[model samples]
Target chain A: MKKIFFSFVMSFVAPMLFSQSYKPVQVNFKPMFGSQELVLNDSVYTFNLKDSVYIETLKFYISGIELLCKNKMVWKENNSYHLINLSEENTLHLMLQVPKNIHFEHIKFYLGIDSGMNTSGAQGGDLDPTKGMFWTWQSGYINFKLEGKSNACATRKHEFMLHLGGYLYPYNTIQTIVLPMPAKTSAIIVIDIKTFLSAIDLSKQHHIMSPGNNAFLLSQIVAKSFSPWIAPSKK
Target chain B: MDSTFQKISIIFFLLVLLTAFVWVEETAFKIPDNWPKPKYDFTKNPLSENKIELGRILFYDPILSKDSSISCSSCHLQYTAFTHMDHALSHGIGDSMGTRNAPALMNLAWHSNFMWDGAINHLDVQSLAPISHPDEMGENIVSVVYKLNRNKKYRHLFAASYHLSSITGEQVLKSISQFMLTLVSSHSKYDSVMRKQSLFTNQEKNGYALFQKNCSSCHTEPLFSNFQFVNNGLALDPDLRDYGRMKISGDAKDSLKFKIPSLRNIEFSSPYMHDGRFKTLNQVLNHYTKGIQKNNTLAKELETPIILSANEKVDLIAFLITLTDRQFLFNPAYGFPK
Candidate 1:
């Protein structure tokens, strides 16, 4: 009777002890132009272009997401840079899990790559240099990529890939993003690209590749886009 | 058939087969009769046939690239002294052009540093640069390890080589370095002359004298490089704006400094310099003679202009040519596995 009871307990407890699950969160990206909005089916994001802008190519990376609850840090995933290549699809879906029993006041992350990763040699996944996020001659990461053709521009439909990344002194693209969580279960941060276009005056600055005032400003705008959706309604 | 006696017999047969295999692959490396002892402390990673074989496969395999398009062999080809000859600039995945020229890779165990700038301090970490460079192998060590770990063939190879069920990044890098360190190039005609097995022609003899007088101060003999840092006085590049040693040391005194490259096989390895600017031997000699610009940190030996005439230049070129080791270049063992 003793041996049978022990076996029964082992069978019931083994799976429960081994299995670890995390709460899931979904982010929907939408592009917009003027008052019109286009839902990206694959990665469809809205970009509010003040004027007609020719879209050639758009690529960028998002990284460094941390989950927290009740002012206690729970899970921190650093150096997680993922490219958002718009040419491939119209919408994007990224499903990530936040470990259970995590307590924190808010969730924090970064829009661009961290400083260490920019110089951490080649990496797999989204951080690979072959992904076109790395510069060959110069040692730096291309933080935010935006390139297209415009008649008003002097280059005029010329190939443009604005790789914005600088980690050294004077120029640093490692921007911090903080999101306040709702009173409920999880936090969902949506990046509205249409808002990004409206925030920038393209007539003043069209292309930016290196880390400078432009990168710092652009990263700030991107971070701001995530702030509004930080704590959705409790409904 | 399923009795204990049959099982014991099968185990005994397996042990004998394993011993036979070990014996067959037990070919040990023999250092050249008179060369200096290798600086690599082989005890850290013992010289074994299985590790070396696996290293060679990884070195030649293109799966290290993101799209499986480029490999170490793409730049460090076996022939032409293991330095690419197709273009001065080394090309990586997606036809991206690297800023620096691919240096010849041989006698690596004797050298203490790597790259034109010596960014990496250890041989174990040297492969990391190329593996991650956007214009080179264009892959990460982690991804490469994961890819290898997922493959059945690599799992078996790793088991045989490292006795591990799965391979790690450290193992992968070390294994490749093992094969590269085995690329000993001490069998050149120059080496034979040192051993008194052959004789140099009159022109070659004269060339050696000139090399000793003008070039030996920097391009030392035996290794053909003193493994020292010096400023040879190449003008600053405007576009790339690369400042070689200073960039790493962060010291202004070391500005424009570069690791002195080995003159061994200078014939096939061109164009020269960190950027491969000088394509001909004459151009290099001319730079040493008339082109060396005065700088605060220039090598004292090259501070004064080297005044070599046409004949002297020819003689120096002849001596540099003798450093070529044809035996090592065409060695079938270094070739791709059939």
Candidate 2:
């Protein structure tokens, strides 16, 4: 009688524990600065703008990642902020843990640090002040950083640096991006920098250091530029 | 078996009681009565006597700067309500002039934004501005951390306060914030009157009425300032070309807007305004009545001229003097860690 009762308990408890454990899903991000794929410091890509421009540096934050199934959030990564640098290839891939049996139909994330984190004191890891993404002059993190040299720019060395970040209303630079996931467990999301740069008149509005209308507009464009690649899964 | 169970229960109860005692002793941030809840969320960085003492030491230490000559105290002196007296703009390391005046520091826990432009939204990270500014400390956080780690004094303090093996930039910043958070200035003559502990003089009473009629709209009561960014009709400084809040928000509408400073220690924290343009209360009153430069972005309240007679100005100045909290200005606890 004792053995039978023990077996019955194990049958229910074992599956419960197994269901609690999650499977790791790896998502790869590919950043393309125009028609060509982004290669930091390679200087092979040209701007989609009218003038001849070379892409040198492209780094931005992707944070608050959430997995949604049937329009309901199934899982969300804690401390999901990631800083993706075009020069660093390893940062392009992110592994997110999700419930084993749940089917995640969509992925949602912010292009910049959320206001809650921004107001909170100095944080560690990707949000650390040591990272160049943080602005010492201001308290907030730089959401998107795009630096390059262009013939159209009138400044010395023909350089343009756009450090966009602000958490206030009317000039809030944080942008939310939602993408439909493919049937595969793992998928690639392409961030086409061409769509963002093409929309901006770089020569006229090259230097965007502070948060404002320009930063807000650029953030919106960048948020819309991300799409899920439907190619066959490697696994 | 019952005896054994009772003994174990007694031991557990004693342990819990001891832990609670220690926790209460460590967390001792008291909110003053009749004041709004502080804007700083203290749950993330709990206050402790050791951490505050460590922070006080850091605030006075020049080692945080590139050259070990300039400290936060150099620009912010406690006696003069934590503002540099007799300087139009803040003088930084090596006598470098900052574009804006170092505003008085008091009641910082109530403040959500820092600097004249409101660039820094959090008090915890506000110190980073002066620490890394080329004209200010001219020292990076990486170097500051390295310096702190090498110093035996800081290492010992960090171990005692944070129980960490090594010093970190976050620790330094948060410690300073803990110290700044304790600077609550709620013991002025105005506070006495508000609490009905004392009566305001006839002149002060009249001035309070006038202040309510004119300045109270922006400089709200209890805290004495609403702490919003508003263009107060000061002409743009041609040399500095500081667009104030506009530079941070990138909005044309926010041009010339600066954070409204608290009037807790107005007498000591002068010359006034973002640039320290006014040397006396008389000048400030005169500007409000006569010197308002009309512009599109000027505060709507100031657009209609503030009418103040010479006698009324004197009365207003008298009321402003009531805001001086000598107790806070010379509080030994807030003074340099000896």
Candidate 3:
């Protein structure tokens, strides 16, 4: 009787204790500027806008992805704004999981932080300023971003950066994208750089560092391009 | 048998005492009467005296800096109206100069947003600006948190304030907000005059009227600011090329707009505007009367231009002095923690 009782306790307690450890996953993001999609190692595309433009850096934030199981919300990160530093190409990965109990039909989530969190004070994880996705002057998170110089542009290889962020009226630029993570035990979200830059018109507007019309429009276009991945059910 | 009943009663009383302790720890914040409702939603993080004190210490401590050289008090000195008067632009760690003037921090509970550009939406997270800015504290939140966690004093303070063994970023921000919220500046001479306890001189009364006509539209009453971003017709600096609210709002109509500052304690906070262009009250009045810029988004009230005479300008200056609050300036609670 004692041996049987001990077995029952171990069976229930063992799984509960071992199930909570987090396993990190890498998310591969790719960018395509202009018609020609720029490759990761391709001799940095020397594209000129007007003056001597040299693309120095591009950074932005991605937040609030919900893990789904069989079309039900399994779990979601409370605060999830990811800083994408293209300078370090391989530092992209979103850690998420589909619970064992439910069979996940797909995964769904927003691309940028919600309005509530943006107005709310500083947060931990990717939302933290150590990530460099926050603005120092007007205190809000930069939801989407693109920075670099264009030689063709009027401002000589002057560093042009667009720090896109604004959740309030007239300047709200928080873009939303829902990608389908198909029913799989393990999967990697491959983000191709070529796909993103193909739609964005860098020459017409090269520098947008704050929340405004340009930032909002560009963020919308980026969200639209994400459609190919977000709606993979048809693909 | 009587001993058994007595022991049961004692155990029940101990349980009740423990419940009462938890109840007090989780008590909600109550808005003080006769004060404007707070813009911040206190339901998120309830107030406690312990948390407010911890935030006060952190606000005054330079440990939030990369080199422990500057604290929030470095720019926001308690005296001189919580403003640094010597320099136009706020100079930070290693003698780095920030782009804009560090506005005086007070009555933050009523401010919908913070900074000259309305950049920071919430008070809890405002510290991140100075903390991470290369020209400011030059410290990252994670590193600062780690440093605070390592320090025995901060750890004890956090434990006392939050009833936790470790301090989290949320606790740190919330505690700081508590302290900043307590910085009430409603006891100024102007407030007293309004309350009918004190009287303003003829010069001050005339100045107040001129201010009402020329400045009160943007710099409203009581708090002395509408808290809205406006262009105020100040010409953009060629070197800085700041577009103010236009940069944040992205609206072409908002070009060159900036937040209208409070007139309270305006006498001491000279070199005003976002860039600290005006050196004196006379210069500021001169701009109002003759220096109105022809921006497309200029306020309609200032379209015709405010025509204040030399003597009227002096009266306006006198009224501004009434806003100087001696009590607030010397409040020991807002002084350095030491």
On lDDT, the stronger of 1 and 2 is 2
lDDT, candidate 3, B242-307, per-residue tens: 888766555788788888888777777766888888889888888888898887888888889788
Candidate 2 TM-score, C-alpha based: 0.84
Better DockQ candidate (1, 2)? 2
Q: Which candidate gets the maximum TM-score versus the true structure?
A: 2
DockQ of 2: 0.36
Residue-wise C-alpha lDDT for candidate 1, range B137-241, written one tens digit per residue = 777766888899899989999888767677776578678878988998887778889999999888899989888888898887788888888889999889878
For all candidates, state DockQ relative to the true structure: 0.03, 0.36, 0.28
Candidate 1: lDDT of A19? 62
TM-score of 1: 0.59
- Candidate 3 ranges with C-alpha deviation above 4 Å: A1-106, A124-133, A142-175, A178-235, B1-35, B309-311
| Full candidate order by lDDT, most accurate first | 2, 3, 1
Error of 3 at B335 (Å): 0.9
Which digits, one per residue and each the tens of the lDDT, describe model 2 over residues B1-338? 99999999998898678667566547667887889988988888889988898889999999989998788999999988899999879887888989999998988998888999988889888989999998999988888889999999999999988778998888888999988988888899999999899999999999999999999999998898999999998988899999899887667999999999888899999989999999998999988999999899999999889999899999999999999999999999989899
Between prediction 1 and prediction 3, the one with superior TM-score is 3
Off by over 4 Å in 1: A1-235, B1-27
After superposition, candidate 2 runs with Cα above 4 Å error: A1-20, A31-39, A46-56, A70-72, A86-90, A148-155, A183-185, A192-206, A224-235, B1-25, B303-312
How large a fraction of the reference contact set does each model reproduce? 0.00, 0.64, 0.55
